[model samples]
Target chain A: MITGMDRLAAAIQGKKSDRIPVFCNLIDQGAKELGMPLKEYYSNGENVAEAQLKMRERFGYDNVWSLFYVGKEAELLGCKELIYAKDGPPNVADFVIKTHDDIHRLEVPDDISAHPAFQETLKCLRILKSEVGGKQAICAYVTASMTLPALLMGMDRWMELFMLGPASVRDELLEKCSDFFRKEITAYRNAGADVCVYANAFGSTDFVPMRLFRELSLPQMEKDLKPVGIDGVVYYCGGARMNAVLEQVIDRLGIGAYYLSPLDNISEGKKIIGNRALTCGVINDIMLIGWTMQEVRDEVRRMLDAGMPGGKFLFGTLVMPYNIPEENIRAMLETAYEYGACVEEATS
Target chain B: MLEDVITAYNEAVFDTDRERALKVIHDAVDRGVSPEDVVFKVVIPAIEQMIKSISESFDANLAQHFMTSQIAAEVTEEMLARFRKAPEVVGHIVIGTAQGDLHSLGKRIVIGCLKSLMIDVTDLGVNVPPEKFVDEAVARNAQVIGISAMMVHTARGENGCIMVRELLRKRGLEDRIKIIVGGAPYRYDLELYKTVGADASADDGITAGRVIAGLIKEVRR
Candidate 1:
């Protein structure tokens, strides 16, 4: 039996595995599996790890995440409060950088692992590593430099400063954000994160102009990834189509993997990526909330048909909705496993 | 002269140059342009055009949208105070994030655009329940309820627009108040608003202003 890690490795190396690897980014859905409050479930790393292991076993996906929530990164930086939802991920209530002066005062803790906000995350990573370290890929999320400030401040304010900038202020904030990003990626790597998802929605043309992406976002991303290196880092744009900049990311950052948005054309993505890096074709999981079983199966088959031809492709989801019916999820995975089987392997 | 002002204002807002945009508006007003004309003819049309011109850079252009909306609201407020007679508001609407969703940026942008378009807006803030959405729309005699949900779970969740739609039906307000939803999720699935029983959905703040205005007309009829 090929391990999940082996399957992903095969896909990454452009070799035919027994079947294509399916990655379910089930974050809040863990609470549903445990019948616990989302807040309580995410408050402790053991609970998150337990849920990840259980969900992986039940759903038979290829990866688990140590990401508590997107807001956890804000909490580590200085956010004082977070709003937890009954059926959604928590959000930062108190933005650390509320004013221009706050940016100057904001500090990236020298040792992020020592920060209280990151302790639970490290614990989750350590446990996932200990239990399924080499067999299953433990994914961790690291917000890229350009997008991290949006977490520190609100997105609206960040946009104002980023687009209509006093260059000094924008650069100052980006410098601090880059420092924090570099440190966070290093910590996640040290704690046994097999894949670091470099999340920067602004990196894609869907969010910014192509010129701005090259001039502003790309330089900061390059700087952030420089010291940490991009060996196992997968460039993600939060589910924004990144095909427009895929070549540039590969050429400049030399990232090993690319998580294409569901909005992106899978065939075009594969053609662009070629064999240079792994291409993950993400399903629009938001639609799963209302899509019929047949719809799910057909969509999964279509994505597999488009992505599986050229090797180095992985089937995945973009933050599985908590309200998605259990049967729908089953249908998606079952279809992936059935249709994603390599032709030669299935015939043999 | 109005055309020059509109052109200057459009270029300033599109550039995300707040200071320049304001200077253009203030200059136009100082030149004896009716406050109403400055708003309806200059600011509103300029913002609509900016949103129309946005193509692949929707997210990146948020800065432009934000500046345009903010400047429009400011100029409208200043102009409203100076109007020879109070300009008639086009319609009234209440807006907020769907329950369990705390995102407010999209809602804020919509409110700014609506205000400049002569639409009266009542913001109920984030994480507002369905009951509040319908109740406030009714109490305020609003023609439409705008729900913003940044996440899939919140956008399609039972407590989101779905519940608000249910509440409207229960209270027999369906004919009176229409529902419109906008957010990242709606952009991903264009027909999600229909699944959630919303009257319509818009892709951004500018389009939202137009959609809600049309819904307001429906309510009036």
Candidate 2:
């Protein structure tokens, strides 16, 4: 019997694993169900380690990330943070480093490890690596440069600039953000992250046009992520098709995975880039949003049936489902454990 | 530039040289083009086309919604700049994004379209405290107060209007300043606009402009 981590490693490495890898992200609710507070888990290394173990044991998923989000980053970055009580994601206070002139004020850290968020991610990754090392893959969660800068600039005003900034202004800001992420990725890898997952929130055209999208964002991965051998995964919540043009992206960088996104033409996406690197994710939202236990099993089974035909599959959402029902989450974990293993090739 | 702008706008649905597209309107207005005709035939249908596109899974890398918004803002600002130099348009409207919300794209779009048509617009940027909305409405003597919400969670912030009405304690003035609401989230529940104490709401800029134009005409009469 293969362990979950070993199975996931086999899958990413394109080898025969016992089962498919279950690598879904976690939210605070799942942690509290096991007696960990969201805030404490973030700051206290012991609490974070406990929560990571609980997530692994309960869900039986393959990878446990160093759970770093923008909130802690915001708090650590001298931004006002609104702490929520038992509900909602904690929010950053209203302060922005808006405009091109403000860009000059943007500080790229010296040695980068000095940032609290970076420190926390490193500490959490060390614990996860110690606990899950060689057993399952450990991911260091990182935001895309375009997104981190936008948040730091204040989400509202940054959004306004998307409509206002010229190609040059947008590129400049994205580059700064990219620079920040790249610096952090190297830092994250040093702290024990096997792969740094890049979460780019705004590449969706539901809000931005493609021209600026390409100019401002497309080349960021390679320029920023390549130096550390850091494998990149672009994860956005609602699917956006612009991501499919990996020819330009992958040519410049090492893109290891694409999270489950409806925007990508999964079949075509697999055909285009799956042969080049590890291709994972295609779990549907309906399965996790409001489906029954059997229905959830059937959904994962369906993805396994449909998406796994060519190989290199990782099981999960495109964007991690925040505040998902724990029952459904556990049901998903069970489904992955029960059915996600690899088999002999027809005994040829 | 025009060709790329059109392709980007048409392809993404949200892409348009709002400045150039609205130029057609401003030019028409400059040469005595009927505001109603320019709006109904040109701007209305075009933006409606865009509204349809955004409604159909628009993306920044794949679709051009935000840039379209930028164009809209520039066109609106240009028109407003031009309009300030001209004769009074005899209309005043206040606009804002609801509280606990900072998205200004949709509001900026609506404000831009109104400004291009030579209407007066006072934009209260995102996460506006309700008192400020009411305060701005009273101070501007706005004929209509417009509110926009883009996300489902942010729609909860529309509770600011009820706060405004209650804080003012005058349904007459509150009613006089007709509250208008619009955005992606509001599309599902038209009554949400009403529930938030808005007198009217439209899902897109065209209908919203038309609604405001009519409201202003009525107030002027």
For each candidate in turn, the TM-score is 0.92, 0.74
- What tens-digit string does per-residue lDDT give for candidate 1 at B23-96? 99888878888887887799888877866665444454455567778888888888889888988888999999
Error of 2 at A270 (Å): 2.7
Give the 10-residue window scoring lowest on summed lDDT in candidate 1 chain B: B55-64
In candidate 1, which residue pairs get closer than 3 Å at backbone N, Cα or C atoms, i.e. clash? A207-B60
Best by TM-score: 1
Give stretches of model 1 more than 4 Å off: A165-167, A343-348, B1-8, B23-36, B51-60, B78-83
Per-model TM-score of chain B: 0.95, 0.65
Proportion of native contacts found in each model? 0.45, 0.28
Docking class of 1: acceptable
lDDT of each: 0.87, 0.60
